[model samples]
Target: MFMTLTADSGADRAETWVERRRPALHPRRSWASPEPFVRRPTEHNSGEDVLGAMPWTRSASGYQRITVAIDVVVALAVVVAAAALGGAGWLTAGLLGLLATGTHVSFVAALRGYERHNLGDGPAEFQVVLRSAVVVAAVLMAVAFLTPVQVPREAVLVGLPALVTLACAGRYVHRRVLHASRARGQAMMRTIVVGSTVSVRDLVRDLGTAPHHGYLVIGTCLADVVDDEAAQVPLPTLGALSDIPQVVHDHAVQVVVVAGDALGGPALRRLSWALRRAGAELVVAPGLVEVAQERVTVHPTAGLSLLRLEIEPPRRRLMAKAVLDRVLGLVALVLLSPVIAAGALAVRLTSPGPAFYTQTRVGVDGREFRIWKLRSMYVDADRRRAELLDRSDRDGLMFKMAADPRITPVGRVLRRLSFDELPQFWNVVRGDMSLVGPRPPLREEVSAYHDAVHQRLNVKPGITGLWQVSGRSDLPWDESIRLDLRYVDNWSVTMDLMILWKTFRAVVGGAGAY
Candidate 1:
């Protein structure tokens, strides 16, 4: 059969193509077919108004404007304060402040820190801000030695750190606000996924899991090989891959995610050109799921760009982590001793058992450690576990019951506040655990693990890690293990610090504690 490609909208009228095809076992859906495709309702197609409705919408350049304003204010306030406090002449201090602020902002801009696309998500934003700060510091040091002007020591010592801290804090606060907006479905980018049926479905599922990332999947376009499985995807079938351009235009899509090899080199390039004219961003997924940006670098060779994966040696950072864990763990243990004591006292008074609970948990290298916690359940809690197995709220190896009968009234409060885990700091100090690592698994849990899951045993389990910060008991068994394994394979000291910061927030919110 001969098929003449056509455009539905006047804007796409000038660009049209044709294809000759033979009927296959599974006939492809036509855009002009009287049957309605799986497109979203008219309300979902109102995403074109999402950014214009709000002054600070993430998809607009307003986010970048806010970021740059924050950076300028922070840099100026810190430098000017330092210069004035150091007793510099008014003119000198003013000039110095301007120079420093300009240099700092320029460095950040040079690093693409203020780009709207990089503003709301990922560590790249913070990483670039940090890099800019480091470069500014080195430049200031050069100015101090190589020039006649004497840069104030206080500015170097105080201003740089203050600038970075305040800038990063601003970014964090802005991100939180953006996330809140996205959760309410306010600032999301209208997204269309294009690939094979299974690939499109998988991408949709993963994207749905983290709505805060802001790509709202409105529908999907199947590749040339349409199959029965296409019906299983939750997203509506916009059309076949060849119809992506028209689909993007009709839906007013902001982002087009190309998954798998639905479009080969020339076709993908052509799609990019089409998307550019439609003012939509084209994101090609290389199918490397959950890989950290730090591990991947792009190398352009012979007119093609290849991704080079670099694995940092674990041993290089292990010693630093060990030292940090012991120092911070001991300090935290000392500072929080009174709170732990109060929790233990509460547990003891309310339950007919010791205040502390100890259990043997498999740790790094499959070695066992006596994990400690403030007992939040009755003495017979362990004995009653088998009886409650059928009623467990969670699935897979991990067992969690939202309303377990074994939990004491006091235990519920402790668990809610996460004070029950305070005794684990002592374990951290004792070198049995790190400040951040995989969740320590039960011996029974370890025994049931598959080979891939065993990778979690490579590092010492933590008092608080990705699993703890990311929904805790609310996460399913498979999800929890996936997070732990991701941490084991791609953790840095920076990631540990980020996890610790998030732990504080999670504990305070107490959303998924049960």
Candidate 2:
């Protein structure tokens, strides 16, 4: 049977005996004995464990509270502003303020629910707008019925849309600023690894590549069975598994990740108990390299954690893609009809080919589709592609030339402003593409892709996506694939709207267009 140490008076003696029996259990070269420290009884004795088990971190909880507070404040401010615009009356304003606050709280709750379900991040812009509009509409109808405020229904309608737009826009801006700040090393979580040196080293190396994830590896603890010299990972070897409780306390670690296949059931249970007492989250990294998060699930049975890994299918339903394409494409074509005509005329007058170009690109499940675009290159551009292959300016599976000779003067302006993509909005409406999705590949490009690369075809191709907004033609192929896969694993309507909004700004600025 395994020995257990309770968190009472006996802890100090037990810890001292363990330390004497195994000096190597303590951190490397630390002469101080582990006997001086005493483990505190858990707060669970006071019935606080229920609240403590809430999944959110302290920082995340604070953010949620601040967000709620801000929404309430904004709702109150809006009520005052509306009243000042001639909708004044204390009773009316108070009612409106209550309604607005209730709406804000409801939307915030919806957003939180979405996040909790891992459906995506935050509520979609359209959903929020729709909800806000319903509330405003009801308020206006009530006011119209209740009092002779002399407010124009049309004016209220127009002003309400703008207000909703501003609120959503402000949220988008705030989130972006927060994400940028976090990316640049603010508000990061301090993490420590508990495992064999090799596993910890590899995990650290993988996480180091994505600074946006906001993980800071402070140190690593080698398993008790492993020797001290095996700490080949770049992080300092803080101690062994037995010393985890002390290391966590000393470093104030927010997350303790156990890596490797070396940990047995008893050690894992002990580490989990220690982590619980220390008020730190415990994450275990199953040694599956390069497997996406969506593919892994944990099942606990009889005190043993069983990980289930399954391969995801590649084909998404064509019907949904088709419907999205047709509806959005038709709407886009209508809205941009004048620009499309002007662009077509410009291309026709300057270039010898048709104003619109068609190319057979690889579509879902290795099928082919004729993609539409405003012609941005000369008729013989394909013939010229080979001559410029050796002078390729971009790297990865795709080819990009910064200053291709095949682009006509009119094409250059269109490409720079992303006017060439206007026609693809029609494709989006036509069921041929999505407004935001994986970038469709050419037949030749698909032919060269390895098995893993085929995962890109899991979703319908999009006119603009992470690749388009990030750096467009400037990004390398491997990084593009990574972003594409990330989107596939975590696609959300909020993400799609965010990408579309960023695409507009990117196109206007003409950054990385070539």
Candidate 3:
């Protein structure tokens, strides 16, 4: 008979799993029983049968290989182009090209660019690629200056930038493809979450919202005392902390996430050893929510590794960001004037309303500002809002409807293509908003905000933010709030640029615009 493990004690509460192949010779043992419950060799318990239960997803190593190949190809292409432009001989160009490619790839590998864990996730991968390029360029310059070997100026001036740019573009395209596959549930790692029921439940919910991250939680292991919250979790309780290895083996789990104080240092170390033998990855949740990797630094002291999280970004960086926002905002407004004018004219001609719509939105520090947008709704849209409030497709203070009746025919196209938001560049230029920041909220939404939600007001609101590129109106209220808070706490210039780049793709795709 198969054994069913439970947190409760006593033989009477013990349960058996699967079919009863033979008679029970004695009462089943509890989880605390000293005698180990060993399973007999049966057709059902074979290694092949267990492994076949959940086959591994497309290996991350495969993508890593593809990334390496792309980088090498891009580096070589850049070298060839630079050599051709510089009129270098074949012998010298071929030698220098091979050397440049080797140096670039070597530096990237040294910086953990090809690490399976970092590939296709977060901004770390792109950061690593850029760092490698900078390092390679510096090294080439140093070698040329310090030694007799002459380095081509074009290689340093042209090749480095092109290589980094092309490499980053290639990696970004690959990441999009990976995300697309993951969205379809095609590429995902089978995972088991271990923690208290509450933590496990929260983790599962959060991970479920971002499936592109590629973790598929198949089951959970309750490490703390079983409580009422256990029933609320959707994943099956595979076993306790002690039975983690068995659960992993049975389910073919590729990743194990340990949340909360589920395991002590020694226990966690042992668990790591067990995972090593089992060929699985162990991830420990630091319990820091919405913290960016940049602000965190690991310090080893007194034989203990402590994570130091910076409270705020430096004032210098904040000043720089403000300048960047204003400059970019002004440039955007200047460059996109024709498009904005065309959109506004369309709105005015197609609907019986003003070309531009302005509304009061809460900005940094509870300040109110008039935000601009090309009119994307009928003249009486605001008046009709109350009647259609009950038909809202979204929950929370913010209101949205996939099939909103208030929008004009031309308005739908404008909203879908994000032409309606172009006029917000003026708000950015006016210093009332940011080029990239938290989502701008209406007065009604701001009034209903709780203490935690109010953290979003610490920075200026934006036309496109983490919320927009993430899912826009499709995102749930809590998820949107979490993203906004994350951005406010962990704001950086690099992060702003990344979000700005993603905004174009999000707007073009228009997946969640409505």
Which candidate should be chosen as best, given TM-score against the real structure? 1
Q: Could you give candidate 2's per-residue lDDT for residues 56-138 as a string of tens digits?
A: 35445555555556556666666546654654566666666566567656765765522322211345533655576566667
Using lDDT as the measure, the top candidate is: 3
Model 3, 139-213: lDDT tens digits are: 777877998766788987998899989999999999999899889886788889987788888998989988988
Candidate scoring better on lDDT of 1 and 2: 1
lDDT of 2 at 273: 61
Better of 1 and 3 by lDDT: 3
RMSD to the hidden true structure, all candidates:
7.0, 7.8, 7.2
TM-score, per-candidate, Cα-based: 0.83, 0.73, 0.82
Off by over 4 Å in 3: 1-58, 147-150, 181-187, 224-232, 249-252, 348-354, 378-391, 401-409
Task: Give the lDDT of residue 494 in candidate 1.
Answer: 81
Q: Write the per-residue lDDT of candidate 1 for residues 73-151, one digit (tens) a residue.
A: 9988887788777777667667777877898889888878787677788788888778877877787778879988778
What candidate 1 gets wrong by more than 4 Å, as runs, is 1-59, 225-230, 301-304, 310-314, 344-355, 408-410
- For model 3, the run of ten residues with the poorest summed lDDT: 14-23
